[model samples]
Structure formats: structure tokens, C-alpha cells
Target: MSTEKPRPTFQMDGHDVPFDEGQSILAAALAAGRYVPYLCYHPEFQPHGSCKVCTVKINGRTHASCTTPAHEGDVVESNVDELNDMRKGLVQFLFTEGNHFCPSCEASGNCTLQAVGYDLGMTSAHYSPLFPDRPLDASHPEVLLDFNRCILCELCVRASALVDKKSVFSLAGRGIQKHLVVNAESGKLADTELSVDDKAMSVCPVGVILRKRRGFQVPIGERKYDEHPIREVAVQKQKGE
Candidate 1:
């Protein structure tokens, strides 16, 4: 007799969906072609659950979809009004927390933060911008670090240590004071073994970490987010990769 257990399924917006054991709600949803917006979740990296952008109503309770494990018959309410509004508020908070002036930002069209704001229909920051006088680091020959644009996502940190095998970045300080720091005695990225083509350089989802000589290279009308929205790009990236 054949011996194979039927795959478990969950109900995301009342639609049956299959998921592997221990798979997160966001993972399964993306695998099933249902895009749930997220920031701190990437296909190649472990879930950090920091952004809370993927918050969904799981079985009548709020949970971060990127880290919350999926189970059979779990009812996940992602597109509901309450959750979408909450995610929108989070997007606004992120906007105000950084100096994300999209008009002149190099990462404007391709940035996940700007893209997420677009996805959420965010027309304004809705609050005063912090406008903190953060420093910019062009110490590296082919890379730049603009602290003003950082949203503390830590994708660079994970890519540096986990993928590139170099501990180049970290989060230091508590709430309202947290910041991304370079791990070097000289507090400079040029002093590290960080190449321009390092995995960390490509993993940033914001304008903070950027490559030199490529600013506006793709042009505004033909950027990644310009063609396909972040939801589609993010979901396709997870499944296609």
C-alpha cells in the first residue's frame, strides 16, 4: 500500500492553501502565489520578524506572517481592513522615521520602503519627519552608506555575516536610538574586506547601501518597482528563486 500523508492546508481569506511542515504563513502564501507585504523577510535569510509589516490576523489573533508557523485550517486574514490599515500605519511610521525624500533619492524607484508606501497607497508621511542629521559614508571606493535613508531592516547585516562570511554591520542602541553600525575599529566600511560586489551590497532593501556610478542608471521610468509593484516583485522573487 502507498503510504503518503496528505499535505496540510490553511485558509487564507477562506481559500485553501498548502504548506510544508513548519512553513511560515508568509512563506506559504508567497509559495501559493498570494502576496503578503513584508520588509524584514527574505527568501535566502532567516526570518527576523522586526518590521511587523507582515502582520496578519491568524486564527483571530495578530501575528507576524514571516515568523509565525502555519498549521492546518489556520484562518489568516491578510487583506482585511483592520490589518491593512495597521500595515499602512507602520509604513507611515517608517517613512517619518527616515529622511526618505523620494523625489531626489537614488533608490526612489527601486527602494522597498518607497515601494511599500506605494503599495499601501501612502501619499504622505502623515507626521513630521525626524530629519535627523545622520552622516553619509563614501569611504568605500565603489559603495556608499547614507545613514539618513536607513530603516533598520538589517538585510545588509544578515547578508554580510550569513552569506558573505563577514560581520560588517549591526544594530546598536534601543528604541528611538537604534542605528546600523559598521563593525570595524576605524568605524569605516572601507577598512573592512567588503567588496563592492559583496552580497551585503545587493541585499539592502532601501537607499542606505548603494553602489557607485549606478545612480539613476536604470532611469526613473524603467526601474524595478516602476514596472512591477513590490508585491509582485517580492512574491515572484521568493517563488522564482
Candidate 2:
């Protein structure tokens, strides 16, 4: 007689979704082939609900799904008009806040922010552009840091501290003034121990981090999220497709 406990299940949009012992609602939903859009929630790292792109209604309450733990029998509502409208507004705010000129960006087709915008049917940034005066850093021999496109996702900061063990990046200031900074006395990438091959370099979801010589090598239309929508690509990637 095999006595094994069944995985705990939750009700998400009229579907029964099973989850592991410590899985978050977002993680469980993605694992169950349900797409909850996100920006700063990477599966490999601890949940940093900074983006709020994966916000969903649980038991009639709004919550960031990436940080909220999944409980059996809880009613979670995703893929709804109200929640999606809020998400679209959030995406638009991100676009207007950043200088994301997709046509000239190297990470144009592969950028997660852009992909999420497209997924949410964002035709324009409903808000006015900020046009913040951010500086570009090309001090590193092999890397380029463009603060103009940074969405303050902090994936690189976490990756550097946790995976790379270099603590190469961090955020500074508060509220609207808050921005990413390099961890160096001279405040430059060339002074830090960041390498082009570090996990931090590859974790940025936008064009903020780019290799010095590798710009648009794959071309625009043939990039990862070019033909497929972010929802399809993200779920497929999670399923190892």
C-alpha cells in the first residue's frame, strides 16, 4: 500500500491547479500551464515582487502573485479584464518612465518589458514621458550600461550578490530618484569585478546591459519574442519547450 499525500490544489479562474509545498501562486500557475505575466519574478531566484506585473486577485483581494504563497482551496482570479487593465496601466507607466526606443535598442525583440507591453495590448504609453537625465556607462572594456532603459527590476543586483558572489550592482536613492548603481569606489563598471559571462550580465530583462560589440547580431524579426507572444514563450520556456 503506497500512502502518499496528493499535491495541494487551488482554484484559479475555475481551474484546479496543484502546487508543491512552498510554491507561490505565480509559480504554481506557471507550472500548471497558466500564464501570469511578470517582469522581476525569475524562477531561479527568490521572489522579488517589485514589478507587480503578476498581480492577481486572491479571495477577492488584490495581491502580487509572485510573493503570495499558494494555499489549497483558495480562490485566485487571473486573466480577468479588471486585473489586465491594471496590468496594462502598469506597463504603460514603465514605458513612459523609461527611454525605451524599441527600434534602436539591441534587446528590442528579446526585452521582457517590451514583450509584456505587447502582451497587454499596449498601443501607447498613456502617461507623458519622463525623459529623465540618466547617464550611459561604457567604462567597461566589454560591457555597456545604459541607464536609460533600466526598469529598476533589480534582477542583475540579485544575481550578482547571490549567484556571482561579487555584489556588483545595487540600487540607490528613494522613490522617483531611485536608480541602479555599480559597486565600485570609483563608481564605474571597469572598477568592478563584473565579467561579460557573469549571471548578472545575462539576467537583465532590458537593454540596460549589453555586450560591447554584440549589437543586433540576430536581427530584429528573428529574435526570441519576435514571432511568439511573451505569454506563449514564457510558459513554453517554463515547460522546457
Q: What is the C-alpha lDDT of each candidate?
A: 0.89, 0.93
Candidate 1 collision pairs: none
* Residues 124-237, model 1: lDDT tens digits: 889898888788988989888999888888999999999899989999999989999999999898989899768998888889988888888888989899989988888778
The sequence of per-residue lDDT tens digits that candidate 2 reaches over residues 92-170 is 9888888888888999999999999988899999888999888899999999999999989999999999999999999
Q: How high is the lDDT of residue 190 in model 2?
A: 97
Please, what's the RMSD in Å of model 2? 1.6
- CA displacement after TM-score superposition, residue 173 of candidate 2 (Å): 0.6
Task: Supply every candidate's count of residue pairs whose N, Cα or C atoms clash at under 3 angstroms.
Answer: 0, 0
Give model 2's TM-score versus the native structure.
Answer: 0.97
Candidate 2, residue 35: the lDDT equals 95
